[model samples]
Target: KRRLEDGEDVLISGFGKFCVKEKKVRKGRNPSTGEVMMLDKRRVVTFKCSGKLKKKINGK
Candidate 1:
């Protein structure tokens, strides 16, 4: 959490990596009412599994 807050990527050996990403604000529409709206920008955390971990999980 702290690493993510600091915009740093964290990696766990034999596991995966966590990184922070910035999302830009954009226009959106409501599905039900068809009303146009502006989506707020925000930071998001993403994770990608290590190749070794993926192989292990797949029983390879």
Candidate 2:
């Protein structure tokens, strides 16, 4: 959690990896009113599973 908060990539060997991604500010529309708005820049965490884990989960 601390590494993720620090925007670092984390790897768990056979499990997978965790990464922090930065999203630039962009224009977006409100679904309800169709109004244009500026989206704020933010950091997001993403997870990618290892092939070994995927195979195990799929029973391959």
Candidate 3:
């Protein structure tokens, strides 16, 4: 988590990779109010399973 916060990616070899991605500010709408609002740009953490992990999960 700290590495991701520091803008560094973390990899666990055969497990997976954790990365931080930036999202641009954009427009969004509320489902109930139908009011449009600007969403702030922010960083988000994402995960991508390694090929080995994927294969294991798929039982292949």
Candidate 4:
């Protein structure tokens, strides 16, 4: 949800796919080697929450 709100692509497990608009290439750092890496732009997936589902959680 935060990723979608930030206009960034998000991949969801079990779900299909979603294309993010205004995609951009990103540079990241490697944890082990501490080396910088480049990440290519790609599509991502996201899910929408249902109001009924929220109500059920709140009931608990």
Which prediction has the highest lDDT against the true structure? Answer: 2
- How far does residue 39 in candidate 1 sit from its true spot (Å)? 0.8
Residue runs of model 3 more than 4 Å from their true location after superposition: none
Between candidates 2 and 4, the one scoring higher on lDDT is 2
Tens digit per residue, CA lDDT, model 1, 22-44: 99999999999999999999999
TM-score of each predicted structure versus truth = 0.86, 0.88, 0.94, 0.54
lDDT of 1 at 31: 100
lDDT of 2 at 11: 100
Candidates in descending lDDT order: 2, 3, 1, 4
In model 3, pairs of residues that clash are none
For model 1, the superposed segments whose C-alpha errors exceed 4 Å read: none
Which 10 residues in a row give candidate 3 its minimum summed lDDT? Answer: 1-10
**After best superposition, candidate 4 residue 6: deviation in angstroms?**
22
lDDT of each: 0.95, 0.97, 0.96, 0.63
- Of candidates 4 and 3, the better by lDDT: 3
- For residues 1-60, write the lDDT of model 4, one tens digit per residue: 676656775654444334356547999899999999998886565455455655666894
Against the true structure, candidate 1 has what lDDT? 0.95
In model 4, the runs with Cα more than 4 Å from the true position are 1-23
Clash totals in order = 0, 0, 0, 0
RMSD of 1: 1.2
How well is each residue in 1-60 modelled by candidate 3, as lDDT tens digits? 789889999999999999999999999999999999999999999999999999999999
Stronger candidate by lDDT (1 vs 3): 3
Candidate 2 local lDDT, 4-58, one digit each (tens) = 9988999999999999999999999999999999999999988999999999999
